[model samples]
Target: MNKIDYKSPIGLIEIEGSAEAVRSILFVERDEIVNTIHHETPEVLVDCLNQLDEYFRGERHVFTFPYHFEGTDFQQTVWNALTTIPYAETGSYKDIAVSIKNEKAVRAVGTANGKNKLSIVIPCHRIIGANGKLTGYAGGLWRKEWLLQHERTFNK
Candidate 1:
């Protein structure tokens, strides 16, 4: 799989995948050294970076590049529901569970949301707590808050 690191406003994002599809887009610590041998950047990865740039610049609201998620059926369902969240809106785990027709799976929905590897593209950050508070985010809650505020700034 090909890989590239993007210096996003929130932090460093490691984009990984093959020429055909993106596998993951995760935030990495600045000091962490990625051991992959450097190779030519795939066109798909380039497109993803470009779109990310547009997003951070407040010029893009949706991601159009191809991306793939590796997870269980339930996790995929939760991730798909996350995509349905509007660009500048927020939803709760219960909201996701309801959208997936598994309203009682709120906790499970939160678990699956944390498993989402495709970050902003899949929009796991949009999921807040049931009480309307920021909650768990693999990339850190600060980044989540930043992302939400960033989207609101652009969406207005």
Candidate 2:
């Protein structure tokens, strides 16, 4: 897999995959967040950096890049539904299941949300808990709060 890194106010972001798709976008681990980008990065990372800059700067809300992910059919369905969630708008896990027409799959939706490797680019942070409380976020609850708050502060 092709891997690349770039700097962000949030930290060093690692983008991985080929031109046909971006497979993952994640912050370096918390311990590595502040670490300088150490790997030799791919030239293909330029688009990732551009899109990410726009995202953080609030000039862009929706991503135009093509992405490829590996997951079960159900996980893919849930992730696609996540993209439909408007930036700056919060949805519940139940909301996601309803949108996917699988109200009984709320737990599965939550599981998929946790498995989201593309992270903020896929906008999983938009999902809240049943009672609107923040729930499981693989990137860490504080980062999740920061991302959702960032979008609300600057969403177009």
Candidate 2: TM-score? 0.88
lDDT of each: 0.90, 0.81
Instruction: Indicate which candidate wins on lDDT.
Output: 1
Whole-model alpha-carbon lDDT for candidate 2: 0.81
For model 1, the run of ten residues with the poorest summed lDDT: 31-40
Q: Per-residue lDDT tens digits of candidate 1, residues 19-136?
A: 8888999999885546333557788988998899899999999999999989999999899999999999999999999989999999999899989999999999998988889999
Q: Highest TM-score, which number?
A: 1
The parts of candidate 2 lying over 4 Å away from their true place are 30-44
RMSD of each: 2.0, 2.7
